[model samples]
Target: MSDFLSSTLLFLLQASRMTILVSSAGLLIGFFIAVAIVGACLSHIPWLRRIGNLYTFVFRGIPLLVQLMLAYFFLPAAGIHVPAWVAAVVAISLCEGAYIGEILRGGFLGIPRGQIEACQMLGLPRLDVLFRVEIPQALKLTAPSLINEAILLIKASSLVSVVGVTEITRTAQNIASSTFRPLEAYAAAGLMYLVICGALALAGHYAERRLART
Candidate 1:
């Protein structure tokens, strides 16, 4: 019994590594896409703002599962031919980018107009003001929310199994099928997710404290 549990843990841990890798990649890529989205949304050009809003609307409106299926199945039909991992990451990035974009937009909006006026009065370049002052403050303001979004992303990554990426939930299913221990297998998977998310929460808290001090 002890050996069985240990082996199952090891197997699930292996699969969890894939989960971490994919989720981290998705979040990192999504964050950059989100920055772009926020820029478009906040642009002076009307069409650019509309395009950003449209992107956020479409991605946020569509179900992530549908998005994943479309990426995995429809893309090949359209001659894109991306690998499963690539498809999963792309879908996750797009979906999460929409949400993170909104979060960042909120953060930007929350910044004081006085700060912008001060920068302008000081003859600071627009780009310098935006990159050095606005973006940094926005990021600091949104760090907690972004951390929460990351945790949610990690949980949502279980859905990647449909794209043939063998993450934790899929590994649990396999273990259950072979060992006939569905409860144990799933419980272990749940525990793994808890550990990962808990650790992330702790790290986020530490970062938030550091940001606060700065």
Candidate 2:
């Protein structure tokens, strides 16, 4: 039993590397996409706002599992062949970007009108004001929520298994099938997820404290 448990843990630890890689890639890409979406939604142009709204609605409404399947299967059928990992990352990015964009929009809305007006009155360029003042304040205001979203994204990454990526959940399933110990296999997987998410929460807490001091 000890041997079985030890070996199972080793295998799971190996598979978890893939999970971390995919989730990290997805979150990074999603964050950039979210910035673009927030810009479009906040744009003065009617068409740009409409497009941004449409993107948010469609991506948020669709199930993430369906999106993953479509990215992995449909893209190839449409002649855009991508690796399973690439498809998984892209699907995760698009889905998470929509949610993150909405979160950022709310953060932006929370910013004081007076501060923005002050920047304008001081003759700061729009880009300078946005980058230096608005974005920083918005990020600080939204840090906790953003960390929650990151935790959610890490959990949701299990769905990437369907795309043939052997992430932690997929590895656990495989172990359960072979070892006939579903409980042990799945419990270990759950524990791994808990550790990763707990670390993220701790990091976020530290960041929030630093921001508070500054």
Question: What digit string (tens of lDDT, one per residue) describes model 1 on residues 1-214?
Answer: 8898899899999999989998999999998999899999999999999999999999999999999998899779988987798899999999999999999999999999999999999999988998999888998999999999999999999999988999999999999999999999999999999999999999999999998898
Name the TM-score of candidate 2: 0.95
lDDT measured at residue 58 in model 1 versus the true structure, 0 to 100: 100
Model 2 poorest 10 in a row by lDDT: 205-214
Taken over the whole model, the C-alpha lDDT of each candidate is 0.94, 0.91
lDDT string for model 2 (1-214, tens) is 8898888889988998999999999989988898889989999999999999999999999999999998999889989887898999989999989999999899898999999999999999988988898778888899999999999988999999988999999999999998899999999999989999999999999998887777
Shift in Å, residue 50, candidate 1: 1.0
TM-score, cand. 1: 0.95
Error of 1 at 210 (Å): 0.4
Quick one: RMSD of model 2?
1.3
Candidate 1: misplaced stretches above 4 Å? none
